[model samples]
Target: MTEKLWVFDTTLRDGEQVPGCQLDTREKIIVAQALEALGVDVLEAGFPVSSPGDFKSVQEISKAVSNPTICALSRAVEKDIEVAADSLRFAKKGRIHTGIGVSGYHIQHKLRSTPEAVLERAVKAVTFAKNLVDEVEFYAEDAGRADKDYLAKIIEAVIKAGAKVVNIPDTTGYCLPVQYGALIRFLKENVSNIDQAIIATHCHNDLGLATANTLSGVENGARQVEVTMNGIGERAGNTSLEEVVMAIKCHSEIPVHTDIVTKKIYETSRIISKLMNMPIQPNKAIVGKNAFAHSSGIHQDGVLKFRENYEIIDPKDVGVEESSIVLTARSGRAALKHHLNLLGFPVEGEKLNEIYERFLELADTKRDIGRKELLSLIGEQMDHSLLVEIQDISYQGAEGKEANAEVTLEMGDKVLTGSSKGNGPVDAVIKSIKQLIEHKVILDEFLIQAMTKGSDDVCKVHMRIMHEGKPYYGFASETDIVLASARAFVDALNKLPIKATN
Candidate 1:
């Protein structure tokens, strides 16, 4: 029988520590419910004593969720423990996760206390928190770099004092897999009361070795993996729950299994990203937009022939519908043909070769070839052009008393016209366009760079707009900077789900 590895998710607690990624009480409850539905064994809802808002969020999450052990974080102080305990009053299964710094650097610089004092504090905090809740987790803040003997001493003391789980974290993400695994093994071998508590691994990804270090811990006797969804946390972030769970499943030799609902991983990631307003990086593992996107010709061909040829895990197994074959300059005729067929353009032989050549030219000059671009390339009807199109645009100079622009947009067969003034020609054009459409949009970023150095040089305007906290990206190039900005803005607007007519 495979040993069960506890999936302790700290996305709400540690992951929320990302500078701007804080989730309110209602948002935290939504995420807690999603995590419970994902079948996490433990959910560290928040650091209750950190703030009243956090305390209320943890309390509400405890009330909202029941299957998973709802947990609240606390410091080594008695007040922190009390507040954390109070937050989980309604929880069916509650855990108090409290700890102190254990590394010599932290003890000397951060805490200004000696190892013995920190050790005493850790034990006391755990003993007190254990009295309030049956499940108590004690974390050694920087245990990866702490003195092995002293670390073992603290671990043994905390276990004897009543911690049911002792978390040895790579607080700074400073250890290599071998070094970190050795550290966990050292505690298992040297700590006399180790068996009294489950050993947990909470590794960070500062060095991009979080998953490796986490699996290493399991190899060396850790049965609990404390992680966050999409690895969203402070700095480089913590071990990713999806990654650790998938690792256990792929490497049957690891001898452990998690109760996580693998298929809900993608949905959970998106929910957190949307509520936190933190867009998931396109290349982030498991939940990233490009996690299953194949753009290379060789990779696309291989995947098209046999998914297993290029994919180790099926996309559906992780809630992703299917692997995306991105059409780009790097894509081959096979991928182009495949996508073209799907888009209702069935060209083969000479016609396909001609279109493929044109596609290469288009793709080389651009970043990607989506369906709209493909259709335009094949001389498809303007009826299916971009969601919005610039019919006519006129811009006054930027330094004029009042910059002015007249714009006309075509949405299907209808033409919408508007005009406005602004501080600059680009702004004037965008303001006029906004008068023509109905969408709450913020110009999050606007950038214009000259492709060439001359006065009449070609300019590329790249812009990002936010709608309901989600970003839409687009770019356009032209000799006139104002025109480029207008086109870029409209392109981005077209990508968004917006209403044009009243």
Candidate 2:
């Protein structure tokens, strides 16, 4: 029988510690539901004693989530435990994870106490927590650097005090995999009554060894692993849940099993990234943009012939839609032909050469060329009809405390100029353009974001306009916000006639 490993997700508790990664109560609940669906055994909701907002988020998560054991982090203090219990009132299965520093550095410098006092506090905290909830976890903070003998004593005391699980965390991400594995093995061999409680490993990735350390702990006898999604946490980060889970499944020698639904990994990562407004690195593992992208010539040919020759894991297994054969400057004839055929354009011989030349020219100018651009190029080659609706003219903003804007419109042989004053300059420019075009389209949403970082940065504006109850989206970028907004508005207006009527 395969040994089952318990997955303890600390995205809510520890992952939220990263600066600027704050999530509101609703967003926390959304992520908690996703984690529950992903089959995490324990969800560390939050540290209730941290702040009122954290307490409320923990309370809400405990109430909203039912599948996983909702856990609240607390110090060994009585008041912290009370707050944790209150936050977990509605949870079907509640856990109190309480711990203190046991290392000599923390004892002498941080805690200013001796090993005996630290062990006493650890035992008392666990005993007190056990009385309130059936599940009580005790963490040996900085256990990686702690004296092996003293660490074993503390673990033994916590077990004696009724800790159902004991966690050995490399809090500072300071331990190598070999040393971390040795620590777990030492605890197993030296700590009396160690078998009574589950040994959990929580590793940090300061040296990029968190996942390796976690697997090493499992190999040495730890049955539970603490991790976070996207490897998000303070400083370096915690062990990535996706990386560890996938590693365990792929390594036959490990033979560890988890209840996680692997297919939901990409969606969950994307949802978190969007909610946090953190852009996923294109080269990030598993769920990144380039995870399933093939770029090399020999690799692409091998992948095209036999996918397994290049890919060890199928993209679909991780919820990725499919592998993409992107055409770039480094692309070959086969890739170019494949992309063209997929775009519903078939060309051969001299025509193919002409199209490929045009594609290379466009690709050189643009960072990325999409299917629509290829189709437009093909349409131009075929002499297809192109509609021209809006024509451009110059415009300027009025100078005053409450300034308006002036606009000019040239469509076909008609020339019209108008001026309007409303809420702001951009609004006035839009109103003046609308009057010239004579189109009454309802503006649904308008957003402006900086395209680059600087004092005088370019801005990109996205606009959604509704015409006849159908929505059309368009975007524009420029150094000036007013121009970007006007161009975005005009772009949306241009799509109106092409939009199919409902």
Candidate 3:
């Protein structure tokens, strides 16, 4: 039988510890509500004693979200536990997380206390917290490097002292998968009261083994996993929520499951990336830009034939609309035909062979082939009468005044003009263009890259729009950024599956 695994998210606590990624109280409340909607079992809001701002954020988040058990972080000190308990007074279900160093080095150097004294402090803290809150969790800081016998001894004491959960944190990320798994197993075997409390794993990514160690802990007996969105935290990072959730999903033998709404993972990742001002790495697993993009000739052919052949997880499962078959020099004829069919062009036999030869010649010169380049190959055989044409675009911007723009477009026999004002020239132009379209479109992403250095450098604009929950992409290159932005917007707009022209 599959067991229920609790997902404890520390994005607002440990994740916000990253430099320059701090969130205000309002932002913390927003993320807390989102985490509740994502079905997290526990949410570590913040350390209440750190600052007044953090205390307010934790208190406010407790009032905003109701599903997840709101948790507050603290040290073994009585004052810290009291403040943490106070912050969660508004929470429907609150947990006090208190801990002390367990490793030899931590007890000797960091805490400058003896092991017996540290154990006493740990039990005392948990006992005090249990009296203040219904649920109390005790963390053994640096348990990965701590002596297994001592770790088990302290954990048993905490559980006896009323801790409902015990956290085994690889604080320095110093343990390998085999070693960490053995550590959890040893505690289960040696600790007399271990069965009374849940075992939680909190692994760091210092050596890039956070996810590996976390999974190993689960394999042994951890019932809860502490994680952050995008693996973001102090130092290297923390275990990624997406990675852990997807890993258990892909492997059934693990015999555990989570309550995550997998389809909302991508959008949640985007929101965190945008709000934190941290860009998701292009190759990041699950939520990266190239996660579902295929460029190799063989890979593209395999994915086009059967998605399962090349992908274990469907893109739609993580909120992505579909996979992307990028056209590059390494692409094969199968990929070429796929794009050709998408553009409403059919070719076979001698005609296809003739076009393939020309495509190869051009592909060798260009790194990526886009729609314009493909159309150039089609030449007179393709119809351009119904294409959307940019007739005129004008915008004005100054220091303090709002930017204003006007746009005119020609589609077959129809001409439409629109005007608007915005925070910037590009925003104004996009707003004006939206007025001319009948369908509701939300600009999801916009990126600009400069190919050359200098005043006349050529810049490429890439835009993505969401219409009816599906994504449509556009691209344009020009020296004038405003003009390029308008062209790219129109390019995506033309691809919208709408029948009306006016």
Q: Write the per-residue lDDT of candidate 2 for residues 352-388, one digit (tens) a residue.
A: 7777788778877764444446666665332112222
Better of 2 and 3 by TM-score: 3
- Local error of candidate 2 at 39, Å? 1.2
Residue 248 lDDT in candidate 1: 82
TM-score of each: 0.80, 0.79, 0.88
Q: Sorted by lDDT, highest first, which candidate order results?
A: 3, 1, 2
The segments of candidate 3 whose C-alpha lies over 4 angstroms from its true place after superposition are: 380-429, 437-441, 446-464, 467-502
Which one wins on lDDT? 3
For 1-502, candidate 3 gives per-residue lDDT tens digits of: 8999999999999999999999989888888887888889999999999999999999999999989999999999999999999999999999999999999999999999999999999999999999999999999999999999999999999999999999999999999999999999999899998999999999999999999999999999999999998899999999999999999999999989999999888888888876776777768899887788888889999999999999999999888989878777888888888887877676777877788889989999975575556767866332343466789998999523689999997866789899999977988988998888777888876778898999999999887777777666778899998899888888887665332221
What lDDT is reached at residue 430 by model 1?
90
Clash counts per candidate, in order, are 0, 0, 0
Residue 92 of model 2 has an lDDT of 92
**Candidate 1: regions farther than 4 A off:** 372-412, 415-502
Looking at candidate 3, the ten consecutive residues that score lowest on lDDT are: 493-502
Poorest lDDT segment (10 consecutive residues) of candidate 1: 493-502
